[model samples]
Target: MPASTPRPVGASGPELHDHLTCVAAPATWLSPPDGRLAGGPGGLYVADRRVLSRLVVTLDGAEPEPRDAETLGADRVRFTAARGALAVERVRTVRHDGGTERITMRNDGDGIATVTFEVTAAADLAQISDVKAGDPPPPETPLRDGAVLTGPDGYEVRLEGRTEAALVLAPGDRFTTTLTVRAAPPPVPGFRPAPPDGPPPWARTPLTVRSADPRLDALVAQGVADLGALLLADEGDLYCAAGSPWYLTLFGRDALWAARLALPLGHEPAAGTLRTLARHQGTGHDPVTEEEPGKIPHELRPAYAPGRLPPVYYGSVDATALFVVTLAEAWHWGMPAEEVEALLPAAERALAWLGTFEEFVSYRGSAERLPNQGWKDSSDGIQHLDGTCATPPIALSEVQAYAYQAAMLGADLLEAYGRDGDRHRSWARGLAARFRARFWLEEGYPAIALDGTGAPVDGLASNAGHLLGTGLLDRDEEARVARRLGELNSGWGLRTLTAEAAGYDPLSYHRGSVWPHDTAIAMLGLSRTGHREQAAELARGLIAVAPAFGHRLPELFGGQARRDGAAPVPYPPACRPQAWSAAVSPALVTVLFGLHRDATTGQVSATPLPGFGPMTVTGVRAGGRTLTFTTEDGAPASD
Candidate 1:
């Protein structure tokens, strides 16, 4: 495929734009507006496998006409439809293992009605990766003995309650039945559930914001709710699953960035995430899995498959550095001193891994391994301005920024804990000096990356925005990059690549899509570098588009410019409750309120931005204490 050719969104898989999602960790239910799951990707999936492929509800052999659908919460939804004079309602609640649906039929006709409520279901037991690759699974003969559905591979889906019933209803009468779908999927060998504790860490330390603009409040509430739903437990520690439908598994980069963005909520999430990744830190080198000593694995899956990634892969170049950055930020956010000390070994290992990159952090691309190993891992993600792909070993601009930040912060942690930190500090200084001389383009902003020939692959992109707060650039250079970001702004959010670039496709995965998390990262960087106006502009863009997507941002959306009444274009296959995208809510609070805690002084500071009007935020955590703050006309005020 050519680099500029746009891959069809969702391809042969089911379309998600018109569907609704209800997710709870390892299990998720995706269905059309109507409650019926009639084949395709709209089914009950558990642990990367589809348990039920076909589930349809009918009255007298006719499907109900959908009338309304409402999402009650992260794990529950209510759908209403009608069949002639009978009004039907279905309430679904999803859990990690399975889901339950309560069906109610109310007759509103003047005359009596005879209705046969029938539910037909079947299981295919298809792997999600195969479905994503457009590969059809072999036909499986499923035996339905009463409400039990038995399929291949020891996959069993049981509808424990009543599913078929014959009823005669009088005028103004109603009938209700609850059907519980339970699945016992083949146990994944390495999968471990987090201990069943109280609510998730974010839920325990609730953060709420109320501002004059109700959209900001709604976006925050929905984002927090979505974040709580994405939390998954591993070895008694909690970390966020990347997203729903496809990426409901451990991803080092996504989990670390999400935890870092969510620091204002509390430090418990960061602590849990750090501990979880530390337990899986790479201890040896394997060419197949790309695991090197002290490196962080890119992602974790149940098992390895041919022509796919390994069970535990370490193909990413930035995750190790992000691991160090996240740990240092967690410490600054008041993660317990003892807790920080316990993870110092892992942080030290990550710093050492960064040291192995002599000049810049670069990845050797191969057909077996990821070609472009930054956050944008797409094959064609790293391209020149002319739409030609950049040959590896590619050194991404943002990876250098992350490495620089990690080295500086790692030194701080080492020094604070009475360890030698001179080496890391000196390394960071050299990185900054080299980055300035080699990465900057004649156009003023940094190049997206350096190609294999050590030539700057110049592409005007949002990647340059990440350099703002990393201290890799001087004040004047930071201002220049911030100004260039405006060219990538699509009126809704920052486009990954500027439209002027040849590879710019509004719906391309990484080339031009507007990822909320990416925009939030730039917002944080802009705010930190004293470009509050630019940060506020990006903040408003995200807030303005939140309502169109039900205030719960998705993984990414089209980079098309926003119109007067039209909503931002949806990328059909994007994950709705993505961890880092949802974490953007708290990130907004951090940027807008200028919330920061001085690690050495143990003092919290707030520098509110103008234009958000009066605002009040409660449940903010700082130095092991809950705080509340109010802003008057965008100026800081005491609670």
Candidate 2:
């Protein structure tokens, strides 16, 4: 079906945010408290589809209750609201304030009399359903007896809804529309639970439905699921965009890498991701359009933009390489070889991108693309001590390795699973051979990457750590890279740009900070290269930080070297327990155990590292069959 056109506005309501959004991205239904979207208080009211005007509510604060109708519950409660009567009062009050609300309540107030209630709408709802539409509403639904409210930024108006004898609330992001005289009615559909259209796809990942502490689990599940929901699935290329609010669209490189870790569990969540992305593989380099032949597109359009949408930009050069990398890796983790083989054309195109997009590499060829490609492609993303960004086509290392590794590994899968024989193997060998000859530096570890003019950046960075992964290096090179990366690894994790670099700033969002996901990547790399000691230490460090700031790890964190007791503080306004970040523990678990699946044999083996504790995963299904494992000492002798 074709997409819905945005509704226009100018009829009712107060000032609203920019209603601009990408048509293909997930639709955000509410006034997103975060900043990923571009509307709200933008001087124009009622331009967006849905508007949250003022929802004024009054509560009964007479004798039996204190002025603070909602008192703190006992038993070391976290909420500031009391139990029983008071709690009911608070829910009712808050619901009234929530427009289009559905709440359950019981009234104990004075017997039916005239009760005055206020429901204000200084503006209008273009769609009434959400913020995506940019249309106007019908004149008959005007608030304040057919009068409109206009003010600075937007408008302001007061209106009234009748207080019926009893009220039944709906259960969605819907507003509260009634007042209760006798008692509150049953919940109507879609009233309290905010619409699910905007949350991430994995927001539905299930934990044990029956838990020891159902209440605690419910809250944890919400946080955990919400954390996953924040993973923006780009439908234009429905790959997971990393995290919510900010990371609200498809990113080719990120989605591929993320799914490499995510797809091991099941096909449902990652399937849409794989199929959609493969559809846009590049064909050839057209510099003006930044299109490279057979190249996979990056940054699927965000649907919630009021302006400034990042459409399916084809600027990213690395995702193509990583795309091949993920497809091959998934095969071992139980991904169907047939499914991956179907995307061979995309892989072919991705490999083609690495060679043709040379001019777009980052300064020093840091595996970066365009001045604003790759994950770190933000305008001011690359920096040194002076906050100066590197020029485009930076080639800061890593890309060559990814290119070679993706080729070799992808070929191995084709030869092994798809029965392509020697030709695939031959292509893989050629790429690896070229990578070793051109990109390697015997003395300065690896020369990071070539600058825009192809100059060497000899900075010691964590970039090589990415090599510890993908089975890219020979044993000796792996050992050397691990030792070099260790120098930049702080106790918490590996720093991105490295402390010894000219632009290293732990506080830099991507430049110097330690992201749990990044660390997880390095941690896996360490284990792969036999750096078990370092891998375990890194794994322990990450798990320790999970509960420190609400058990909600973000995409990345400030890696500022220890200043005082607090260390580098969290980047302001970062989403908590980000999607891939939440995958940290599970992926870290893989690192500690050396979990490998032999698909043809349908067996999963764990060569447990020394520190990994014993655990049991029951009723799990995998290996093209059902099996139970009681693991101990890192070995899962099947049950």
List the candidates' TM-scores in order: 0.95, 0.69
Instruction: lDDT for model 2, please.
Output: 0.48
Best by lDDT: 1
All models: lDDT?
0.84, 0.48
List clashing residue pairs in candidate 1: none
Question: Tens-digit lDDT track for model 2 on 534-637?
Answer: 88877666655554444455566666553334433555434333556655644654665466677678677666666445544332234444334445655644
Model 1 stretches astray by more than 4 angstroms: 1-13, 138-152, 191-196, 304-307, 365-367
CA displacement after TM-score superposition, residue 337 of candidate 2 (Å): 4.0
Which parts of model 2 are misplaced by more than 4 Å?
1-238, 284-289, 302-310, 355-370, 383-388, 417-444, 561-568, 618-623, 626-628, 633-639
TM-score for candidate 2, please give it.
0.69
